[model samples]
Target chain A: MTQIYNFSAGPAVLPKEVLQQAAAEMLDWHGSGMSVMEMSHRGAEFMSILETALADLRELLAVPDNYKILFMQGGALAENAIIPMNLVGRKPQPATIDFVHTGSWTAKSINEAKKYANVRIAAAAPDGRFHAVPKRAGWNLHRDAAYLHVCTNETIDGVEYHFNPDAGDVPIVADMSSHILSRVIDVAKYGVIFAGAQKNIGPAGLTIVIVREDLLGHALPCCPSAFDWKIVAEHGSMYNTPPTYAIYIAGLVFQWLKRQGGVAAMEQRNIAKASLLYDYLDASAFYRNEIAKDSRSRMNVPFFLRDESLNEAFLVGAKAHGLLQLKGHKSVGGMRASLYNAMPIEGVQALVDYLKEFEQKYG
Target chain B: MTQIYNFSAGPAVLPKEVLQQAAAEMLDWHGSGMSVMEMSHRGAEFMSILETALADLRELLAVPDNYKILFMQGGALAENAIIPMNLVGRKPQPATIDFVHTGSWTAKSINEAKKYANVRIAAAAPDGRFHAVPKRAGWNLHRDAAYLHVCTNETIDGVEYHFNPDAGDVPIVADMSSHILSRVIDVAKYGVIFAGAQKNIGPAGLTIVIVREDLLGHALPCCPSAFDWKIVAEHGSMYNTPPTYAIYIAGLVFQWLKRQGGVAAMEQRNIAKASLLYDYLDASAFYRNEIAKDSRSRMNVPFFLRDESLNEAFLVGAKAHGLLQLKGHKSVGGMRASLYNAMPIEGVQALVDYLKEFEQKYG
Candidate 1:
């Protein structure tokens, strides 16, 4: 059987060791004589798992004591509406929300916020091509804005913010779904940080949210109690039966991350891995990556073939050669290879090698 | 291990065969060379899994063609608010939602619904002990109400509705989280039936919503697009990435159910299991189940020892006998043994045997 490297943008590749460990313990987790899925969320076994996961995540992120980490559902897409619903109420009726639209996710946040608040485009990437994050100085932030929303990493558009923007006293809310834990960032920089647990985390259903303590309890009257950050934090994410199995998988991944020397070590490897693919794309006349170098995402690298007609042949050959899901999102036609924390440098090398071989064959 | 029987009300036990199959396929799903968790939701591999799961569920329940099955997140608790938000728009401003408060879950639904629409207590279980499902003849359902809310099975109160209510021209929304697939039901009777996947299904974090076609597009402006029935059904539940891995596990459970002869067969077995324990409780002097005989839950059996002081000793002894999570919810003191579809009759007999031994020693 061919060894496969999966490049799916989300629900992407996971560390093989985590999968192996999960399989080994599927029927009985740590001699509890029950699968983690079967244990009550209130049971001692699952409670321990949740507590340890919470503590481990805090340690890994160096989260401040003033912040609350919540495990939520409905993913970041749901949070597009949930965020404004919870934040805008802190201001006044129909609060204004500032948004710096880098790409797909930011635009989604803007649209959802409009349902709950007034939305002002603080900045938008040039013309909707979304090839780069706009310069910070050009952003039109408002002092009285309820909050500023940003998609730190645009999975589809392949742009990422390397530096945090100063939002003055207003809080910065980030949708870090694609790049969260692939690299290190200051946890205190944002008022709220949410990432869907598919890429660089665990699975699809669970969502990881880190919010400052001050941001709690301001949800609009319409926000679902289960999705209210304050309610979830108060109940320790057990307000609703959490995606238990997903949280367990994420715990295993976090343990694996710790063994690999935490997020900083993973970030160094991610940097090396991203450079391997980007440097090759830069040198190759047959392939081109559109995102600016400064804004290129370490986690998701979307590239296009010089001749559009070769896209199908390129993906077909890549798949046949032990590569998978290399096709880019339909919105941005070409290819995308996501280098999450779980993706080893070898897989990136394999992708780079496949790109070169395909180029040589057609160039 | 003494052959454990897990009785957690939610995040409860699943069929051993299903867990074995999931473990076997944790790393690579049917030669896709990627774990189910690692596949893109839109990719052919994951899409096939989703489709099979959907088809299997629709077949198992004989869901009508006019209904849309949505795979959602946040469990039934989240749906408490989502349901009203999506439903109240079908009526005029300040729509009245009629609710029959049977137990804890029904009370929760009523409270959440009140946030979106006016809630009328069509009926309330006598004295709030929730010993029986209120007689339908006494329910004061308003003809002009937007919808009628009921909890077909209450996990905490251990009350189950033996029959459906007739609401003239009004849709009935049923929360069947605890007993969804434990027995056969008429899916056509309810306009919407939602269940959390922790009990009688697969795992936590996944909520199964079966909604009639006509209920699809009446969401209020505050409704999250991911939670909007119309948007979710139109996208085939991929308006947001449906819980992919949970759906896969559910698909496995559905296939296992078919091998065991579908829901009708499971219903017969469930009847035997429920009767075995209920009969013993009824005959015993030392133990008594409080719920009215007719309203006793086939899935969750909450009972009390004649002497409440023995609760801790009873739970400890049950654990020693490899019967787990026997302690009832704090709101209702005593013990609860959930006989979900995954729980076999042998587990119930063991519980009865333990009850006899304890009675002989303590009576």
Candidate 2:
């Protein structure tokens, strides 16, 4: 069988070891005679799993003690509404939320925020092309905005923020859905950091939200009790039955991360993997990566075929070579290779070889 | 090894065949060279899984073509808020919602509804004890109520509604979290039926919401786009990333259910399994089931030992015999044997044997 590498933007590749461990323990987790799916969320076994996951995640991100880690559902898209429902209540009626509209995800967040608060675009990608992140110096941030929202990495646009923006006194809320654990981050710099676990963490259903303790308890009157961060934090994310099996899988991923020397080690590998592909794309005229070099995402690399007519053939040949899901998001209409933490250097090299072969065939 | 029977209320037992199939496909699903977890929610592989699961669910429930099945998250608890958010917009401001206060689950739903609409208790379990479902004939229902809410099966209280309430022109919404798919039902009767997939469907993170087509597009401005039935149905639950792997496992369960002669056959088995334990409890002086016989849940049977002092010893002995997760919910201090569709009749007989032995030694 050919070695396969998956490059889905989210719900992407996971550590091979993690998948193997989960398969081995699928029926009887450590001889408990029950799959993790069968265990009660409140049971001692699952509680340990949850606690260990939380502890390891906190350690991996170097999260500050003041930040409360919440294991939530509905992914980051749901959090778009949930965040405002929890935060905007802290301000007066019709609170204004400042947003840096980097790309699709941030735009979705902004649109969702409009349902809850007055949204202000503090900055947007220049010329409306989502090829680069706008510099923070040009942002017209509001002094009294409830929070400043940014998508640190845009999966569709292949843009990322390399520097943390100084948001003055307003809290900086980041949608790090696509690039969270691929690198080490300063957790204290942002007031709230949320990511869908499917990308760099674990699976699709579980979402990780790290919010500063002071942000607790100001939920809008209509915020669902289950989604109210204060309520979630008070009950330790068990206010409602959590995504238990997803959390178990995430715990295994965290353990795997530690074994691979944590986020710092994973970051170096990701950097190398991303660079290998980006360098190849930059050198070849047959393929063109549109994003500004400075803003290109290390996790998601979106590029286009120079000829445009070879898109289908390119995908066909790529799949034949065991490079799967290389198709870019439909919204983008190109090709995207997501080198998430679990995507190996060998996979990147294999993709590079395919890129070269495709170019040679039709250059 | 002793055979194990898990009786957890929500994150409960699943079909052993489903678990085994999921393990077999953990690395690569159907030659796709990607685990279900690694596939994009929008990919062809996951789309097939989602469509097949939906079709099977519709067939099992005999769902009408006018109903839209949505794969959602945040469980039924979150739907307590999402329901009101989506439905109340159909009525005038401060619209009233009627609820039959049956048990703990309905109480939570009523509380969450208070955040969005005027909640009126149309009926309550007579005597304020959750021992029986309130007779629908006595309900003080409102003519203009937005929707009538009921918990079809109360996991913690062990109360189940045997007959569907006739709401006249008012649409009925049910939380069938713990007992969905355990029996055949008329799908056209309810305006919405939502269940967290942990109990009888699949895993914890995936939520199944079957809503009438007309129920879409009336979402309040405050409803999250991801939770809006209209947006979700339009996108086939791809508006946000569905819990892909959980949905795949659910697809496997649906296939397994079909092989077991569909829900009708499972319903008969469930009836037999519940009768085995309930009949033993009624005949034995050492045991008692608090729920009214008519209101007793065939899926979750909560019972108390005659002597309260022996509670800890009873649980210990049950665990020793591989009767796992029999401890009842904290709100109800007793033991619960949940005979979900996945639980075999043999597992119920094992519990009954344990009950007889325990009574002989401690009666």
Candidate 3:
């Protein structure tokens, strides 16, 4: 097989070792003569896998005792609506939810949350381009808001929050889809933290939501029981048949993360990789990354060629060089290289190498 | 490895050929050097996989040209709420959705649907036992009901609707979770037929919803955009990142089904498998199956030992004989052998042989 680097923003690249093990076990998981896909969710084999995955995730994120980790479906987009449906009932009818509109994901959360509650934009990034997160001083926090919503990392816009926004008594709900396990954080800081398990986790179907126990049990009557955090938490994420195979793969990833010395060590590698690619883009006049320096995402690095006409040629050449999925989100219309936890620094070096050579030819 | 036969109700057995091909392609799918899990849902590689799976499924079901197939998440359980959220808007406010209370799944749908609209039980099975589908003559469907809901296969109760009930102009929404591809059905008969992919399709987390084009755009305000049929159809099920790996596996299953001469041939094998097991249970005084014969599910056969105390021993002995997941649902305890499309006739024979041997020792 060719040495390939996949740069798709999401449903993105996974560890090769994980795929190898999954392939080896696909026909007969643990000599059971049944694929993990064939195991019942309530059965002993799958229960153990689910439990281990949950425990390992807890250990990796240092999730507080009060937090419940829910493995759900429908991705982050569903959760935009699901979150408000589950949380708004904590207050009286027609509650208000505060949001800091950082980029596409948060803007979406605002729109979906509107259907369930009165959505109030506490802050918005100054430019329409979403180049940075607004400073906390400028936020107009609501006194009795149901909860504050934020997208800690925007996959498409490549803006990330380096500092946790303080909401005081108002609980913060963060969408960490693009950068969940790439670095360490204080899990206790937020009331609910969710990540669609595509970019930094395992697969596209599974969404992981970590919520404080107190935050459970307030879902509105309109909330679907499957997505009601209270119901999902009570059932240990098995209110419905979960994405079992995806959970299995995520379990494999959690195991791999542990083998690589957990989140702390992985964070160091992510920093190095992100810095290498960003540094090259910074030094080169041929390409530019627009996000504010401190707000730039370490996971998804979206950039543009100084000569815009070369975009198509750049992607085609990148593919021939065994680099793939380099086209940025259509919403952004440029190039993006996602250096998820699964992406090695070697892949970064290759991307940076490609960038330099392309500049030399087309600058 | 032992020659195992898996009878898990959902997340049940899948065709061995599908698993083999999945394993073979896990690392470098079609020489792309990317596992299907790692491919973007929007990229050409995974899109092709999704398109082929949709095309194959459409062909196998002989789906009408007027219907749109949606690949979603949350299983049939979530669809209980999602279906109402999407369809109730088709009727006036405070719309009534009539349902045939057949078994556990239908009961769940009734409860979930009540959150969005008025739910009326059009008919019940006459008893709490759910032994059969109530005949159409007993149905008291609301004159202006939004839709008629039915669980075509009651997985837990082992009751199935072998005949489709006419709902007139009221669109019939069928939950075919546990028996989707195990037999052939006229797709145009139901307005929407949704199945959780774990049983006869591929893996868990992926739900297939076949809906008529006319039923596309009436989603309620609370409906998550990701779960709205119109939005999902418009985006080709990519409104959000889909369950890519499960879709790939499902695609493989569809191809395998085609190779085995499609649904008609599979249905013949299914009938043979169901008869072989049912015949033995019928002739024996030591065993009994409670579901009415005409309504008995060809997929999940729930049976009981005359000596109820021997249940544990029977399960242990069956496990020793490499027949797995024969234990019935916790709600309806005894034993159930789910012979999905993946279960070859030999596996069914093995189960019957085991049953005979166990009866000989304990009868």
Candidate 4:
């Protein structure tokens, strides 16, 4: 069988070791005679898995003690509404939320927030091309805004914010769905950091929400109890039956991350892997990543072929050569290479080699 | 090690063969060169898995051609809010939703519905100590109700509706989270049958919403697109990631169900298992199942010991004997033996044996 590299933006590749370990323990986890999926969330076995996963994730990100880690569902798309519903209640009725729209994800946050609050576009990249993250000085942030929303990494447009933008005393709410744990960040710098656990984490359906303690307990009346951040934190994300199997797999991935020397080590490798593809794309005439170099995401690299007609042939040949899911999102037609932390440099190198071979044949 | 019998209400036991298969394919599914978790939701491999799973589920339940099977997230707790958000839009402002409050789960649903619409308790078994399902003929359902809701199986209160209630022309929405797939049902009878695939299905996080085609597009303005049944059905449940790993496991479980001679065969075994445990409890002075016999849930049998003081000791001994999670919900404060389809007659026999042993020692 040909060695394959999956470049799916989300629901993307995972560490082979994690998958192997999961498979090995499917019938009986260790000698417990139960699959992790079959274990009760409140059982000692699953509780230990959940605790270790939370602890490892905290350590890997150097998260502050003041922050609470919540394992949630509905993904970042759902968090778009949940964040505003939970945060806007801290202020008066119809609270205003400041949003710096870098790309599709931030725009989604803005749209969903409109359901619960008044949303002001604090800053936006010109013309919706999502080429770069607007500078902090360019932002028109509201001084008393309930929160400042930003998509730290736009998976579709391939843009990332390298530095946390300070929006005065207003808390910064980041949609870190794509790039979470692929690199390190000061947890205290943001009021809430939420990521859908697909890329750089574990699987779809499990969402990780890290919120500062102060942000707890201010949910709008309409917010469902299961989604109320304070309630979730208090119940340890078990107010409802959480995504248990997803959590277990995430724990396994966290363990894998730790084995690879934690997030810092993974971050270094992510940087190297991403650079290999981006550098290659920059040098190739047939391919071009449109995003500004400074804002290009370390996790997702969306690029277009010089000749648009070659898209299908390019993907077809790439797939035959053991490259998979290189197709960009339908909303953004092209190619996207998502090199998350689980993606080794070798996979990226294989993709780069395939890209070159394809270009040499069809450029 | 003693063979443990897991009686968890949910996040419950799944088919052993399904777990074994899942474990075997953890690293690479059918040599597709990627874990199901690693495949893109849009990729051919995952798409094939998703399609087959959906088709098998539809066939197993005999779901009508008009009803779309939507793989969703956030569990039934979230669906309480989502249901009204989608259905209430069909009526005017403050649309009244009638609910048959049989037990804890339905009560929770009623509470959540107040946020989206005016909810009426058309029928409740509060006076019956939540031990009986309100007879269908007794329910005073609102003629103008947008939908009538019911928790067909209450995991907490050990109550199950043996018959579907007539909701007039008003759409019937059923939360069959615990006992879904344990027995076959006519899908066309209800406007929607939603179940979180944690109990008789596969895992938590994967909520299956089977909605009739006509009921798809009436989402209220406040509804999140990800939770909007219309958007979800239109997108084939790929509007969001749809909990990939959980869905894969569910597919495996659906296949396992077929191998076990489908729902009819499983239902027979379930009847035998429930009868064994219930009969033993009735005969023993030490243990008592207080739920009305007609309303007793085949899936969850919540019982109390005649001597309440022995509760702690009972649980301790049960654990020592490898009887796990027999402790009932905190609210109920006793014991619950959840015998979902995956739980064998042998497990129930073991529980009955233990009950007799305890009775011999203490009766």
Query: Highest lDDT, which number?
Result: 3
Worst 10 residues of 3 chain A by lDDT: A120-129
For A185-241, candidate 1 gives per-residue lDDT tens digits of 998889999999998799999999999999999999999998889999999898989
Models sorted by lDDT, best on top = 3, 2, 1, 4
DockQ of each: 0.91, 0.86, 0.88, 0.74
Residue A51's lDDT within candidate 1 is 91
Q: For residues B142-210, could you state the per-residue lDDT of candidate 1 as single tens digits?
A: 999999999999999999999977787899999999988778889999999999998889989899999
lDDT scores of the candidates, listed in order: 0.91, 0.91, 0.92, 0.88
Cα-based lDDT at residue A159, candidate 1: 93
Against the true structure, what is model 3's DockQ?
Answer: 0.88
Question: What's the i-RMS for candidate 1 in angstroms?
Answer: 0.7
Please estimate how well model 1 matches the true structure, expressed as its whole-model Cα lDDT: 0.91
Q: For this target, which candidate reaches the highest DockQ against the unseen true structure?
A: 1
Which tens-of-lDDT digit does each residue in B1-363 have in candidate 4? 789788888788887878877777777788788888988888888899999999999989999899999999988988888888899989888899998888888889998999988988898875757989988778998789999999999999999988867777889999999998888788889999999888889988899999998988998876888888888888899987879989898999889988999888888998999999988888777788889889999999999988899888888898888888899899898899999998989899998888888878877
Model 2's chain B yields a TM-score of 0.99
Give me the runs in candidate 4 sitting further than 4 Å from their true place.
B126-128
Model 1: residues >4 Å from true position, as ranges? none
Model 4, A330-356: lDDT tens per residue?
A: 888999889888777888989888888
Candidate 3 stretches greater than 4 Å from native: none
